[model samples]
Target: MTTDPQTLTWFKSSYSGNGGSCVEWAPMQATVTGIVPVRDSKAPNGPVLSVPSRSFAEFIAGVKGGAFSAT
Candidate 1:
């Protein structure tokens, strides 16, 4: 389930350029609820995907560790 984006502060990696292919997350809410809110940077008002904190963290770690291949 998703929540009102207006009530949350969203952010993406600063290292990520403004290529419009980035993902934004609401860290504030995650700290309180242990659920991560993810949304497309290209569509702020679009649907938000809520993921469990542990799962989200593992996914991020996988990304950083290059566990996924772009191809």
Candidate 2:
């Protein structure tokens, strides 16, 4: 499914730290496609990662659970 980048309502995850390093995603779009499109907010026109919705959920759960230690 082709999606117009401009139409995507990209939003950063609440888990994102205040630091500059962060990723943004479009939740509404993900629900429809079963794929979550994510990109670096600092580079709006940059490449995007389209992951399976289930995988995205696992990733978020890991983040919230602090499975990955802060560097």
Candidate 3:
């Protein structure tokens, strides 16, 4: 299913604070289509990355586990 990016409500993590290097996601759209629409917070009009719900969940889990940590 296709959705207009402009129509979706995008939000960034509270931890983002005032930093411009953050990512935004459309939770409502994800709930409706099972696809997580992600985009750079600095570029609201830029391209969006559509990730599968399962893949997104795994990515989040890995993040929580520090699998992608820089340290």
Candidate 4:
């Protein structure tokens, strides 16, 4: 099934405490499609990244697990 990129809904994470370095994702779109559409919150008109649902999930898990270092 094909989905319209323009119709996708987007939202930022609660953990993204008003930081300039925040990204938004279309969870509703991901539910309808297997791909998660992500984009920089600071630049909504900028390029978007479509990641696979499973991969996005893993990335989120890694973030929560602190697998990535701020430094």
Per-residue lDDT over 29-57 for candidate 2, one digit per residue giving the tens place of the 0 to 100 score? 89898989899988899888888999999
Residue-pair clashes per candidate, as listed?
0, 0, 0, 0
Worst 10 residues of 4 by lDDT: 1-10
Give the TM-score of each candidate: 0.90, 0.85, 0.91, 0.86
Candidate 1 TM-score, C-alpha based: 0.90
lDDT ranking from best candidate downward: 3, 1, 2, 4
Candidate 2 segments exceeding 4 Å error = 15-18
- Model 4 earns a TM-score of 0.86
Best-matching candidate per TM-score: 3
Give the distance in Å from residue 33's predicted Cα in candidate 2 to where it truly belongs.
Answer: 0.6
1-71 in candidate 4: lDDT tens per residue? Answer: 26554677779888888668899999988887788999998888778899999999999999889999999
Q: Give the CA lDDT, 0 to 100, for residue 61 in model 1.
A: 100
Order candidates by TM-score, high to low: 3, 1, 4, 2
Off by over 4 Å in 4: 1-4
Q: Candidate 2: what lDDT?
A: 0.87
The candidate scoring highest on lDDT is: 3
Give the alpha carbon lDDT tens digit for every residue of 1-71 in model 1: 55588789999988779788999999989998899999999999898999999999999899999999989
Shift of residue 49 alpha carbon in model 4, Å: 0.2
Give me the overall lDDT of model 3.
0.91
